[model samples]
Target: MAKVTLPAAADTSAATVKVWDPVVRLFHWTIVTGVVLNLWVFEHGKYAHRLTGYVVVAALATRLVWGIVGTRHARFSDFFPTPRRVITHVYALWRGEDARQLGHSALGALMMLALMAVLTGLGLTGWMMGLDAFWGVKWVEDLHGLLANSVMALAILHVAAAVIESVRHGENLPWAMITGRKRALGAHDADIAD
Candidate 1:
């Protein structure tokens, strides 16, 4: 059997490090609120739903721009999930090893990308359904519904993963998103200097 070296576990008592920037935090919460409103609070196919969808689209657009030119950890390059990295992360998980990352971990980055893509599609399809040319079009409406469901499914998985990873790594992932900071890296943890 090949030997597998695991990354070191993080020290619980380590100093805190700033990871997420203000823009990243704001974008995350905005999307969460938009999703909640669209899924439950706002009436479907109504003015409020349409308005919330448009706001989500605007937030997604801003996030895309931020991913290109935002702070160190917000830039996509800081945590792009390559195939090899994803596989390595999965393997590490299977082996019960910690791979502490200062920015998004490989699987987290993949989930982030998926959520963003789904949101963009959802927004586009919703807008298309509203257009006069596509008004009352069954396919457009169906696509919109499908995208919405997909986002919900992905969101549930995202939350579960965050909870699992938080327990595994002894860090509050959701709270980190809120406060824009995480426990500082330890000697055994992977160094992700952004």
Candidate 2:
């Protein structure tokens, strides 16, 4: 894992630091748009729907590569939530600890990975539905529907968690993703080095 650098704690200016790079921001918004379009805007099996799926898959593929070689916070290693970390974070949350992470929180990291996996599964099943070998295959269609529903449910939970964390940590996480920066590390936050 790369070193995670944190800002000085004495700084009370509420400054922001760069975290998500342009590639990461683009990938995030692209997925969000694609999900919203496919879920509520575009009709299923329509040209727009398939095109959006392909676009989202392409973004996912790019993200997979970026996760290995992207900027500090964007790299998966920066916040890959191990089981121990997840448990620690959960315990802290249960105890109402601040536990504000400068980058992705452990639970946030897990949610990200889960969303990606569900999206990949959805894309695969959607692609399969278009193949001749799977024509009239109820299972393929059913699986696709299930994955879509899962994505929606997960998305809702993701937003709710973001809101909860924002309240607890005094930072707008969704805005951070858009702005590609976050409030600098505070004294209470666990310090790290780059």
Q: Write model 1 residue lDDT over 23-68, tens digit each, in one string.
A: 9999999999999998775555588898898898999899999999
Model 1 steric clash pairs: 8-188
Model number with the top lDDT: 1
What TM-score does candidate 2 get on C-alpha atoms? Answer: 0.90
What TM-score goes with each of the models?
A: 0.89, 0.90
Q: Which window of 10 residues has the lowest lDDT sum in candidate 2?
A: 185-194
List, residue by residue over 1-194, the lDDT tens digit for candidate 2. 99999985766537788888999999999999999988764555578898999999999999999999988888899888888788888888789874566778788888999999999999999899889999779999999999999999999999999898888778898999899988877678764222
For candidate 2, give the lDDT: 0.86
Counting clashing residue pairs in each candidate, in order, gives 1, 5
Residue 91 local lDDT, model 1: 88
